[model samples]
Target: MTDFDIPSFLKTLSQRAGVYRMFDADNHLLYVGKARNLKNRVSSYFRARGLNAKTVALVSAIHHIEVTITGSEVEALLLEQTLIKEHRPPFNILLKDDKSYPWLHLSDHEFPLLAYRRGRRGGTGGKFFGPYPNSGAVREALNQLQRLFLLRSCEDSYFQHRSRPCLQYEIRRCSAPCVGLVSREAYQRDIQHTEMFLNGQSQQLITVLQDEMLDASSRLEFERAGELRDRIETLRLVQEKQRVYGTDRNMDIWALVEFQGVTCIHRLVFRDGRLLNSKNYYPDNLAGEEDPLLLLGYISQFYLAGHAAEGLPAEIIADIDSDEMTIVLDALRQQFDRSILHSRGVRGEPRQWRAMAEENARVGAQTRISGHQESLRKLERVSQLLGLDKAPRRIECFDISHAGGEATYASCVVYSEQGIASQRYRRFRIRDVAAGDDYAALEQAVERHLIRMQEASDLPDLLLIDGGQGQVGRIQQVLERLSITTVHLWGISKGETRKTGWEFLWAAGARQPIIPDAHDDGFRLLQLVRDEAHRFAISGHRKERSRSRGQSDLENLKGIGPKRRRALLLHFGSLKNMRGAPREEFAKVPGVSQKLADQIFAQLHGEDRSV
Candidate 1:
C-alpha cells in the first residue's frame, strides 16, 4: 500500500465512525465512502492492498478530504448519498437524466379526474401517480383512466360555473359531474376504483367491474351495463400493455457505456409499476477509459447534480458494484433520509435492463459525435469559400441601424468553433457621426471596436459587415487610418432580389467579387453569422429608437429637465399620458412642485401657462 499524507487541514477531526471524501486536483470530488471505523477505512488506502493505478493517480492529486461522524452504518450510508448528490464527485457512477417526471394528477372534487402535470404541486387535490418517464405515458394512462372511471376532467372554475354538460359528456367521456348527472356517492366509488387500478389491483378492479355489469344487466339498466362493459374492455386492454407488474413501486434503472472515447449514461424509469420513459445522456469528452471507473465517476457526478434522489425512488439498479457504489447509496439515503435499495444483478431481468440502458448510451454518443463532425465540416467549407487562411474559428459580424438617423447604433456578434459566442458579442451607439449617414456610421462603429480591442489586446480574427461595397470600403479606410493590421474584413451584399443565397462577398483591395457556392456548407455558416448580426443590430436599434422617442416627447413639455422628465415618464409609463395628465396628477410627480405642476399642465393642455 502506498502511503499519502492526509491534508493538515482535515487531520484534526475525530476519525472514529463516519464517511470520508476524496477530491482530485481540479477540486472535483473523486470518491466518497463510509466506514464503521473512519481511521481503519481511510488508512486502508495506504496499505499494501490499498491502492490500484487509478486510485494511486487520484491520491497523488488529492487536494483535500472531508469526513463526517455518524452513529451507525445506516446513518453513514444515508449521509454518503446526500453528499454524493450534493458534490457530484467525479469517480462515482452517475445517472445523468435531469428531466422532470410527468405525473397524472387527479383533481379532488365531486367528480375527480386525471390530468397531466409537471413540476411542484399546485393543482387541487387527488392522488398523483407519477413521476412517469415522459408525458406520453402519462397521457396514455390518463386516457385509460377517463375511459374506465368516467370522472369529470374539466377545470374547477369552469366545472363550478357550468349550467349544462359539455361536449365531453355528450361523447360519454365524462359523467357530467358539473351538471349533477352523477351522484357524489357514485363518483366517489369510481374514483376509488381508479385508485385501485393504478395501484396494481387490476384483477380486483376487473372482478368488481364484472359484478357491476351483471347487476346492471339484471336490473334492465342496459345503458349502464353497456357502459360498464366498455370500461371493462378498456381496463383489459391497458392490462395487456402493462410491461412490469409489481405493487406500484417506482424505480429507475441506470447504466453506463464507455466506448470510442465517449461515455453515455442511460436511465430507464418505471412509474406505477410500468416502464414509462427511457433517457440517454452523453457526457462530454470522456473517451478512452476503463468502463467500470468511468461508470463510477459518471454515477457519482450525475446523481449529485440531478433530481433523482430528490424525486427519490424505491430502488436503484445498476451494473457495476464498487466500494464507491456503497458510498453513493449511503449518500443518497442520508440526503433523502430514506432507505433506498441499491441492487446488483449478474443475471435475469435486472441484467437485461442494464444492457438496454448501456446500448442506448452508446447510440446517443454516436449521434452526438456525428452531429459535431457535420458542424465542423460546414465551418471548414465556409472558410474555403471566403478564402480565409484557416476556417474562421472566431468570426465577428457587424450591422448598423437607425430610425432615419435617430439613435444610430451598430452591433457586433461573435461566432467561434462552438457556435455563437454570445458573451463576446457587443453593441455600439454611433456617437461622433452625423445622422442618416450610413458611411459615417459604419466608420465610427469600426473605429470604436478597433480602439477598444487595441487597448485590451483582444481583436477578432475576421470582421463581417452587413452591407455592400460602400459600408465595406468605409470600414477598410477606418482600419487603415488607425493602423490596425491584424484583422481581416469583408462585407455581405444582399442578393439581386434582396433574398438569401444570392449574396456577394466584398473584400478590401479586391476588384473581383467572391461568390460562395450556393449549396456549400461555408455559405450556410456565413449566412447564419450574417443573419444573427442583423437580428442583434435591429433589436438594439429598436430599443434605442424607443428611448429617443420618449425623450422627444418629454422635450415637448415645458420646464421638464432630465430629472423631472425621467420621473414623469417612470410614473406615467409613457410620455403621452404624462403630457395629458391633469394638474392634480402632475402635482403627484416626485419632483414637481404645485406651481410647476400647474404650469406644466396648462402648457400641455394649451391654457394660459407659465414656465
Candidate 2:
C-alpha cells in the first residue's frame, strides 16, 4: 500500500462530522464517505491489520485525501451523496447499496401525490426527483414536501374514494383534495410550485413564495407568513439534490477541457443507469491547445480502437456541440456497425449530465495543473510558446506601487523551476522622479536593476512588466541604452473590469499581443508572477509611506541641529506651517539667531539662497 502520513493527517482531523474524499496520485477522486466522528472513521482505514481485499486495493491506490466539515451527521450524509453523484468514484461502487437508489416520486393525478418510489423510476411516475443517496434522504425530502406543498401521498384508489378528511389532512400534511375540502385551483398551485422546484427553477419559486409571504405579513396573517418562511428553508435543503438524472442506461459523456496550455478529456461512464466510473485522459503531445479536429480524432481513437475500458456505451455525449461532431457520429456508426446515439446539444436531464461531465473535467484539470511537476511543465511550455532554446530557469516580474503619487516603490519577484525564489526577490525604493509619474518611476527602477545585473553578470531569462505597451516601451529603451539583448520581455495589460485569466499579453517587438486561451498555463504563470510582484510592491510601498509620514523632514536637513529644529517645529506646530513661514518667523524661535534663521528659512522652503 502507498504510504500516507496517517498520523499527521489524523492529528489535524477534528472530531466533528463531515465528508472525506480519497484521491489517487492522478488526483482522481477515489472514494467519498460520511462520518459521525471524522477522526475515528478516517483513522480506522489505517488500522494496520485484518483488512479486506477491497480495502487493501483502495488503500494501495490512495495517494492523498481531502475533507469538508459539515454541521451534523445528517448534513454530512446529504453532502456525501451529492459528491458521490457528482464524481461517482470507483471505490464507492465497490460498496454496493442493498437496493437501487431511491427517488422522490410525485404521482400524476388531479390531486398530485409526493412520495418515495424505489426500484424502477420512469415507467410509473408523474414527476421524479433524486435517486438520493439513501432511503432516509428521500423520506426527508418527501416529509418536507408534505409540510410545504400539503400534497397527498395516499394511493389514487383511496384518494378517489375518500368521503371525509383523513388524519393527514387534519394534521396539515395534505390539502384533502379527494374530500373536496380544498379548491382544485388552490391544489394545482401547490402542484405547480412542486413542479417548479423539481425543474430547478428554485430561485424563481423562492421569489414568488417570498413575495406572497410579504403580502401575508402586510395583511397581518402571521401564521401564513411563518409557514411560508419554513417552506423557503425546506425548499433550500430539498433543492440541494441535483436534477441531473435520467432513465438512460449505459451512456458515456466526454468533456474536454484545455487549461494552462494542457488538454484533458474526461470520460464519465454510465452503466445500468448509474455512474460507473469517471476518468481523465491527458492525450500525449497535445502541445497546450485544444483543437476541435484533434478532440474528434481523440474520440475516434478512444472508442474505435477499443480503448474504452467499459466498452462502447449506448450513447456518447460530448462537451462540444459544433457541426463537426456529425462526421464523428457517422464514423462511430460505421465502426461499431450499429445505431449508436451521439449528442452534444442535449436538453433536460441529459443536459445536466453534460454539465456534470465538464465540471468533473475542470476539477481533474485543476488537480493535474497544480504542484511542482506542473509548474516545471508550464515553464517548458512557456519557453516553447516564446520560441526559446530551453525552459527559462529564472523568470522575474516587475510592478510599481504608490499611494496616489507619493512613496513610490517597485518590486521584482523571482520565479524558478522549484517555485518562488523568495531569497532572490528584490524591492527597490524609487526616488528622484516626479511623484505621480509611474513611467519615470518604472524606468528608474529597471535601469538600476539592469546596472546590478551588468555588474554581477547575472540576468533573468525573461522579464515581465505589469503594464501595457507603454511600460514595455519604457523598459525597452532602458535595455537598449544598456545594450542588453539576452533577456525576453512581456507586458501584461489588465481590462477595465480587472478580471483574472483575461489579461492582454504583450510581447516586446511583436505587432499584436499573444492572447492565448483564458485558462492557458503560460498565461497563468505570468498572472501569478505579476500578482506576486504587485503584492510585494504594495506592502513595501505602504511601509515606506508610513515610515516617511512618521519622520520629520528637519532630521534630514544638514544645517538644522536637533534643538533648533525642535524649537522651530514647536513654534510653527508642523513642517507644512513652517514651510509657509518667512525668515522673521524662523528667528522668533527662542534658540535661533538671525543669521541661522535665514539658513533655516531657505532650507525649510526648499529655496536656495546665499547665507
Candidate 3:
C-alpha cells in the first residue's frame, strides 16, 4: 500500500481527458470520476474552496490514486462509469434496485424457446429483447406473444422428457414441438414473427402473416391458414393497444421529487410508442446533495454495466438537467455505441409522460411521509398509556417457539415507531435450556442479547415478552443481576381462552395487570409487536427443525462425516436427490473411497450391516 501525497499526485497527473480512481487507506475504492482535463479535475478536491462536506470527507480518506488516460472525453466518461459500477464506492449516489430487470429471451434451439427471463449468464447465444422496467410488463408481453405465436415456454429438460403434448399445447399456448406436432420450419416462422413483434415491427408482421395466410389458403392448407389468420388478428390488437403512446418512439422518462431530505424517483419506460412499464425508487444516504447532481449520479450508475443487463435506448427524458449532462450523454453514447437524445423538456407526449412521472414521485413521497406520521402517532399513544418520560421510540419484543421439544428457538423483534426496525432484530438458537421450556429459553435469550449489546444506549426503552408472570419474572431477575434500572419490561399474557384481543399486559415491579381496551391504539400496537415476535420466532424454529431433521439422517451414517456428507449433497443438489441416486453414483463423490461408497450405498438403500 503506497502512501498518497495529494499535492505531489496532482502535480504528476496528466492534463488530458481520463478517468481517476481514489482509494482509502485499506485500498478500498472511495470514488471514481472522469474529466476532460485530468489534472484540473483531480486538483479540484484539494482546491480548498467550495468543497462540500462529503467531498472533503472523501479527500481526507484517500490514501492512493489511479488514473487511466483515454483518447477522448467520451472514452473517459465511459471508463469512469465502468469503474464506478465495478467498485460501487461509498461516496457515489447509486441507483436503487437497478438489477433484476426482465428481458425476453429467444433461445437458439431446434425450436426456438421464448420466455420471460430475469437474469442470464452472459452470452447464452440468445436474442434478448429487453430490460423492461418491471416483471409484470414482461409477463404481459410474454402472455400476448404466447397467444399469438404458440411458442414453447417449457424448459429444455422438460421438453426433452415429454412423452406427449402438455397442458400448454392443449390450451393452444404452445405448438408442442417436443411431440413433433408442429414442424421445424413452421415453428421457425412463428419465432421470426415474434421477433418482429417484440422489435416494434407489428405492422410489418401483420402484413407478412396475411400474405402467408393467403398462400396457405390457396394451397388448401386450411389449418395452417387459420393459424396465420389468428396471428394477424393478435398482432393488430397489440398495435391498437399501443395507440396511447401515440408515436413509435422508444425511450425512458425519469422524474425526481425531494421532500425534507428524502427523495423519490419514478421511471417510465416506453417501448414501440407504448408505456410498457413504470418503477419507483427512494435511494438513501444522499448527504444533502442538490437534486440535479443526484440525478446525474443516478443516471451514470444506472446505465453502467454493473446495473444495466440490457442496453439503453437512443433517447432519455429527464426532469432535471445538470452541467454534467454532456459528460453523462457521452458515457451512455459510447457504451451503447449510438447517439443518445436526452430530452429535458418537450411540448406533447413526452411532456405528458414526464408529468405523470413527476406526479408519481410526489405521491410516493407523500405516502412515505404518511407512514412515518402514523408510526409517530402510535408511539405517542403508547407513551401516554405506559407513563413513559417520552414516546417509546425504541421498543423491543421477544418470543420463544418450538414444536414439542425439538429445535427450540428465540426471536427478538425491534420497533422504533417508524414501523419494524429490521436491522436491529435478533434471533437466538436456544442452548443450555431444555427443549419446550419457554421460561428458561426466554431467560437465556435475554441474557445473551444484553451481553452482546455493549452500548448502554442500544438497550431498548421497552422490553416486551410473550407470556404471563413466569416469563416476565425470569427476565426481571436477569435485568436485576445485570443491575439495569432505567429500562422497562412488560409481559403479554393471553386470557384464559388464549385468543387474540383477549390479552393482559404485565409491567415490571407492578403487581396488578394493566389491561387496555382492545380498540385502544396503543394496545393494538402492542398486539402487533407481540404477533411479529411470535412470527419471527416460529420462522426460525421451523428452519432449524427442518435442517436438524436432514442433518440427523446424514450424520447417523457410519462412513459419512461432515465433509463427505457436504460433498455428496452438493453433487446431488439435495438429500432427496442423493437418496434417489444409484449405488454407482456414491463412488463419484470426491471424498468417498470405493469401500466407503459401498457402505454408504448399503446404508442409504436399507441394506444396512456392519461398515
Candidate 4:
C-alpha cells in the first residue's frame, strides 16, 4: 500500500468526465471528488509541482484510486454527491445538520390540525406548506394561520373530548366545532380559506370574503358583515406586507461567503412574489474549492435531502454560475416532477434576494472566522492538556435537566472552531428514563446520538458531559455498547465546594480530576460548551413543564375538556382570572351553554373551597 504506483494509475485514467474516489492504505475512503476530465484531474494530483498543503496530504495518503466515467461534466458533479453521501468520506464538505428543517403540516382530519413538523413526513394525508427557512418561521406561519383562519390547532383526543369552545374560539382565532358551536360545513369553509391563504391565493380569498361581506350587509346581517370585513382586511394587510420578490418567478437564491477556507451559505426562498424565508449554512472543509463546485455541491445536498424537496420553486438564482447548473436543473425537474430554472444573473427581486444572501454570508463568514480563531487557541490548549493527536475542532457537550423529576430533557450542544454550532445542537425529550434519573437520561441521550453517528464520519473529535465521574461512566458504557472507541469523552463537574473556580474535569481512565487554571482558554471553552448544554436542556425542560402544568390544571376541572378549557383561558387570560370570572361570563363564551357554564363555575369554586 505504501509503494502504490500513482503514475501508472494516472496514465490509465481516461479524459472522460467522471467521479474519483481516493482510498488510504487500509482501503478506507479518504476523499470523493469529481472532475470534468478524469485523466487531467487525476494527473493534476500526481503533478511533479505546484500542490497545496491539503492536496499534498490527500495525495500522500492515497493508496488506491477509482474513477467512474460519465456522459458529461454535469453528470460527474451529480455522481460526486452520491458517492460522498454513500461513502461519507472524511475530506468532503458535509452538511452538518443532517436532519431536515421544520415544515408546517396541515392534517387531513375532519378538523385539520396545523403543526410544526420536522424530519419524516407524517403518514396522515394532508398538505405541507413549507420547508420554511427555520423553525421560528414555521412557528410564526402557524400562528398567523391560526389568527387568519381560526382553525382548531388542537390534537384529535382533545378535540373529541371538547365540552365547549376553547380559548382560541373566545379569541376569535377558531370556529369552535368541538361542541357543535360551529358546524362541520362552516369549519370546512374556514379550512379552505386557510389553504388558499397559505398557498399564496390570498387575492382570491379576499375577493370572496369581500363578496360575502357585501352580501351580509345587503341582507341586514350587520354583525356577520363586520366579521367578513375584518377577515378581508386582515388578508389584505398580510398580502401588502409580503412584497413579491419576482413578478412571476418562484426562485431559491443561494450565495456564499468564504473566509480562511471556511464557507457560509445563505439561502433565500421566494414564492409567488413574496420572500418566504431566508437561512444561513456553515458547511465544513470548503477551503480551496472553486465557487462553482462549492455552490453545485451545496445545491445537490440541499435539494436532494427529503425535507428540502418539498414545495419546490420554479427557478434558482445563485451568486455563482457553473457548468453543473444544467445538471442540477434536470435533476430537480425529475425529482419534483416540474421543470426548474437556474440563473446566475438576474434583475429586480432575484437580484435583491442574492444581495441579501451575500450580505448575510459575509457577516456569517466574519463571525465564523473570529469565533474559529479564538476557539482554535482554546482547542489547542485542550488537546495538549488531554494528550490528544492534535487540536479538537469539533466538541459536543451534553447536559440533563428536569423539574422535580418531571418533563426531563437532555441537550447536546456542539462547539466547533466556529463558536456555537447552534444548528447541530439537539434536544432529546427523555421519555423512557425514570423521572429525576440524570444518569439514565444522559446514557439514553448519548446512546441515541452515537447510534445516529454510527454510519457517519462527522463524529465529534471530543465529547463532554455535565456531571462527575458517575455520569462519565454512564456515557462510557454507552460508547462501549455502541463500539465507538475513538471519541474523547470527559466530564465537567463542580468540585467539592460546588463552585465555578473549583471545577473538576474527569476523563476516562484518569486517576484524578484534571483542573485547569480558571483563566485558561481551554477551561473557558469547556465552560462555554457546558453552560450552553445546561441552558438548552433547562429551557426545553421549562417549556415541557409549563405545557404539562397547564394541561394538568385544565384537565382536572370537571367537564372542562380541551375546547371549554381553551375558552376559559382565552376569556380570562389565565387560570387565576378564569377561577375569579363570574359564572355569567363563562356562559357568554361561544360554545358554553348555560348549564356547562354553571358546572364549570361550581367545579372551580368547589376546588377553591376544598383547598
Candidate 5:
C-alpha cells in the first residue's frame, strides 16, 4: 500500500459543492463530510497550524480521499447525511439507535388490537399513528390509550391461542377481545374514540361520551351509564390539565448542552397543545466540533435520516441560533418542500420549554459523567481484585437460552467504560447442536464471536462466561484453538440456590472461585451484564419460537399458499375441526383443488380419499 500523496492530489481538486470521503490505509472510511467548496474544505485538513487534535489525528490516518460532486449545496448536504448514515465513519457525529422510529399500530380485524411497533416488517394489516421518538414513548402512549379504551394489545398469535382472557382483561386494561365477551361493534366504538384522541379531537370525544352516558341512563342501564360517566369525567380532567398548552400547535423542542466534552441533547415532543413524550440523545462526536453547527447537524441528520418520529412537526424550537442555521433551514425547506418555520428566539411557554430542555441536558450530562467516574472506580477495584495490569475498558458476557432443546440462542452483551453498549449486543442462533448441549452451543458461539472480532481487529478486553468452570474451560479451549491470547476470560456460576449475588467467579486455570460480596460494584456490574445476556437470549429465542408457531399448519403441505391456507382455515374454522372430515369438504373450500385436497387430507388427517 502507498501513502496518500496530498500535495500531488490537491493539484487537480475542484472548487465545487460536493461530498468528500476520507479513507485510511486499509481502505476503511475514516470520515465523510459535505463541502460548499470541495477544494478549500479538503485542503483545510492538510493545513499546518489550525486543526484540532482530533482533526489532526483524522488527517494523519488518511491514505486517500474521494469526492462526489453534486448539482447544488442542498444536494451535497443530503448526500452527506446519506453517506454518514450508511458508512458511519469514526470522525463523524454518529447517532446511536438509528433504527426506525416506533409507532402505535391499530390493526384492522374483527377486534383490532393496539400494538407498539418499531418497523413495518410484520405480516399484518394495521393503521400507524406515530413515528414516536422512542420505544418508551410509544409504549407509554399505548398504555395510556389502552387504559382509556380498554382495547386489546396482545399479539395475534397469543390472542388466537387464548382459551380465555388473560391477566390483562382481569386488570381491566382489555375488554376481553380475544374471547367472545367484547362484541365487534362495541370494540369498533372504542377504536373510534381512541382514534379521535390520537387525532387531537379530545373535546369532541368528551361530548360524545357524555351523550352516550345520558342515553344509557335514560335506558335504565346504570352500570353502562356509570362507566361512560367516568370516562367523560376523566377526559374532562385531562382537558383541564392540558388547557395550559394551547390547542393550536404541535412542536418538538431541542436543547443541546456540553459538559466537560460530554454533550447531551434533550428533545421534548408535544402534539395538539399537550406534552406527549421527550427523550435525551447522547451523540458520539469524535471529531470534537463544537458550535451552533453541532445542534444544526443533529437536527438535520435526525429528520433527514427519518429518525424524527413525526417527521418535522408543525413547529420546532431549538436552543441555538446562528446565520449558519439558515443554510440548514433552507436545505430542509427544499428537501421537505414545505414552509419550514424555525426560530431560536422564543417567548413565554416555548422559552420555558427550551429552558427545560437545556436543564435536562445539563443534568443528563452531569449524571452520565458522574456515573462514568463511578464505573471507572469499580473497574479499578476489579483490576486490583483480578491482579490485572490495568482495568478493562470493554467487557463482554455470553449466555445461552433455550426451552426443551428448541430454538436455542446464544447472546453476547457488551459493557464499556462509558456504560452498557446495547447496540453492540448480538445473538447467535445455535444450529446442528444436540438438544440441551449448552457446553457445545456456548463453545460454538464463542468461536464464531472471537473469529469475527479478530477479523474486525476489535477484540474485547475481557470475556465473561455465564457459567461455571466447565463453560470457562470450553471457551478457553476455543481461544486456544484460535490462538487468541489477549482476551481475558472468566466464568460466573450460580450458587446452589441459583440466585443473584450467590455467583462464584472462575478464572482460567484457577482452582478456587472468587465469591465477592453482593455490594461489590464490580460484582454487581458482572451480574448486570450476565442478566442482560440472559434477557437478550430469552427474548430472541421466544420471538423466533412465536414466529415459527405462527406459520400455518398447512405450510409444509404441497401446493398450499397463504391464500389457500387462509381459505382452508376459514372454511373449516380450524385444522382440528377438519380431522375427521372427508377430502370433498376440503375441496369445497376456495382455492383448493380436488387432488391437492386429497393430499392435504392424507398428510393432516392420515387418510386419503377422492373428492
Candidate 6:
C-alpha cells in the first residue's frame, strides 16, 4: 500500500464521528486523529493541494489506515488520545512529559495529618497535597501549615515508640500528641484548623489566631500571646508570597510551540482560584508541521493519557478549538461524570494568558532542542575516544569481589547508546575457586559469563574488566578456551592516586598500554562504563560480604548439614541472634530437634553451661 492507497481507505470512512489511525509500512502508527465527520476530515489528507509537504511525506509511506467508530464525538476523542499515548504515534502531538505529579496525602487514621507524597501509594492515614510543580513548594506549604496549626508530622513508628515529648514539642512545631502531652480533644482542634488551612480557609485561621492572641495578652499570658503572634505572622508571610494570576479558581492553560521540527507544550495549572505552577514538555520531533489543529490533538492526548489528570481542573483553556477539543472534553466528562468547560478566548486577558502559555511552550521547545544537540555531540565524542570499530552500541563490564577468599562474587553491567540497560545487567557467584584468589575469581566469572553468552547467542560489542593486567589475562584465557575470537575485551586499571583520569587500559594481545584519547569522546564513554562496572562490582561485593558475615556462625555448628544450617539462618534472621538464643528458643525453631537444639546451645554456651 502507498500514499494513493491511503486516500482510497479514507474514502471508505463514514461521515459519522470516530477515530482514525495512519500506519507506516513497518506497522508502526504514524498518526491518530478524531473527527466529527470521519469521511470529510480523512478525505482532506489525500487531496494533493490540501496536504503539506510533511503530511505528503507521511502519507507516501502510509501502508495502513484503521478506524474505530464511537458512539459520540467525545468517545472518539478519548479513544484517539488513549491510542496516541499507547502507540506514541510519530505524527501525533505527544504529551512528551510523563513524570508523576506530587500529591499531598493525609493519613486515613483517626489522627489524620497532611503530608507531601510522590506517586500513588503510601501509608494509610493522611491527606495528600498538590502534585506541586516541585518539592520545594510542597515543603513550604507543609511548613506553613505545621507552624500555623502545630500539627504532628512524625511517622507512626516514631509516634508509637516515643517515650518523651521529643524535639518537636520543645520547638513548638508539634503538640506532642504521641506522649499524651496534649489531650486528644485539643489535638483534634489543631487538626481541624490544619484541614481548614489546606482547604483554602487561611483567613479563618488568621482570624482565630488574632482572637486567641488578644485573649492571651489580656489574660497576662505573654508567652502564649507571642507564640500566637508568631504563628499569625508566618501565615501572613505565606500569603504574601502566593501571587494570584487569575480569579479562575480551577483551570489549566495549555500552550503549544513548534521550532526546528520539535514541539514543546506547557501547562499552567491554577488550583483553588490561584496560579499554582506550570509544567513543560518537549515532543520527540514533529518534522516541521506547525498548526493549531496539531496543538489541539496534543492537548487531548496529554490530559487523557493520565499524566496530569488527578488534579484535573474544572476547565481547560487552549489557543484553538478543533473538532478534537469536543472529543477530549467529552471523554473527560465521561471519565469523571462531571461537566468540563472547553473554550477559546477571542478577546480580553484570557487570550493574553493563552498567548503567554504558547510563548512558554516555544521557549521550552528551543531549550529542548539545544539540550538534545548537546547530548548528541557528547555521545559522538564518547564513541570516538574508546577507539571503537564504530562507537560501541552495547558495552558490558565485569567486576569481581571476595572477602578474604570467602563468598566470591562478580557482577556484569551493560550500557547502550540510550543509557544503562538495567535488564541486561547480571550478577554471578563465583564457584570452583580458592578463597582470596582474585585471578581465579576473575577467570571463573569470565568463563561462566561466556558460557551463558554462547548458549544465548548474546555477545556484547565490547567487554570491560574491573582490574589491571591480571584481570585482563584471566578474561583473555577464558575467551581463548571458549574459542570466542570475535569479542573485544579490555581491562581498566586505576591511577596511582586512585582517581579518575589515571585509568590504564589493557586489551588482549596488546603489548603497549592502549590508553584512550584524553580529550576524545570515546575516552569519556569508556570512563563512564568503567565507573559503572566498578560501582556494580563494589555493591555486589558488599552485599555478598554482608551475607557471608551473617552465615559465619553456621560454620561453628559441626553436626549441622547445609540444609539445616540454611533453615537456622532463615528462621533466626541473622547468625548473631542464632548464637545468642537460649536452648528453649533454639528447640522451638523449625527442623531443629531437641538433640540438635541441645547441641547448639552447648556449643554456643560451652559444654559446662546448663540449659
Task: Give all TM-scores, in the order shown.
Answer: 0.37, 0.52, 0.38, 0.34, 0.36, 0.36
lDDT of 5 at 143: 70
TM-score (C-alpha) between model 6 and the true structure? 0.36
What global local distance difference test value does model 6 have? 0.64
Tell me each candidate's RMSD, in Å, in order: 23.6, 20.4, 21.2, 21.6, 22.9, 23.0
- Can you write out model 1's per-residue Cα lDDT over 304-343, one digit (the tens) per residue? 6675633667777886674657887788777667776776
lDDT of each: 0.65, 0.72, 0.71, 0.69, 0.71, 0.64
Tell me the spans in candidate 4 whose CA falls farther than 4 Å from its real position: 1-370, 551-611
Q: Please give the distance, in angstroms, between residue 572's alpha carbon in candidate 5 and its true position after superposition.
A: 27
Instruction: Rank candidates, TM-score, best first.
Output: 2, 3, 1, 5, 6, 4
Q: Write the per-residue lDDT of candidate 6 for residues 1-611, one digit (tens) a residue.
A: 45433422442345555667777778777888888777788778767686788888877877866554433354454456545555677777644353354556777765666677875674454565443434665677678777666788887777789888888779888887777888878878887776666555666666667678779989999999877766655454333211222354588888777543457778866666544444566655344445677677677677677777446788888867556588888888888676778767445445545654664565455344334233355456645555556655567888776657767778888765445555577888888778888888778777888899988998777788888877788788888899997688887887678776677878776776666655454565566667656656655666676576774546646588887875565444456555434334455455787667768865653332210
Higher TM-score: candidate 1 or 6? 1
Highest TM-score against the true fold, candidate: 2
Error of 3 at 216 (Å): 40
Tens-digit per-residue lDDT, 95-200, candidate 2: 3443456777778777777878875655785877765656876687688778778989898878878889899988999888987888999988988888888765
Candidate 5, TM-score vs. the true structure? Answer: 0.36
Give the 10-residue window scoring lowest on summed lDDT in candidate 2: 602-611
Worst 10 residues of 1 by lDDT: 1-10
lDDT of model 1, residue 552: 58
What stretches of model 2 exceed 4 Å from their correct place? 1-102, 105-129, 133-140, 149-208, 216-230, 236-243, 247-250, 286-290, 319-327, 346-355, 377-465, 468-524, 531-611
Q: Which sections of candidate 3 miss by over 4 Å? A: 1-373, 417-419, 454-457, 496-499, 509-512, 551-611
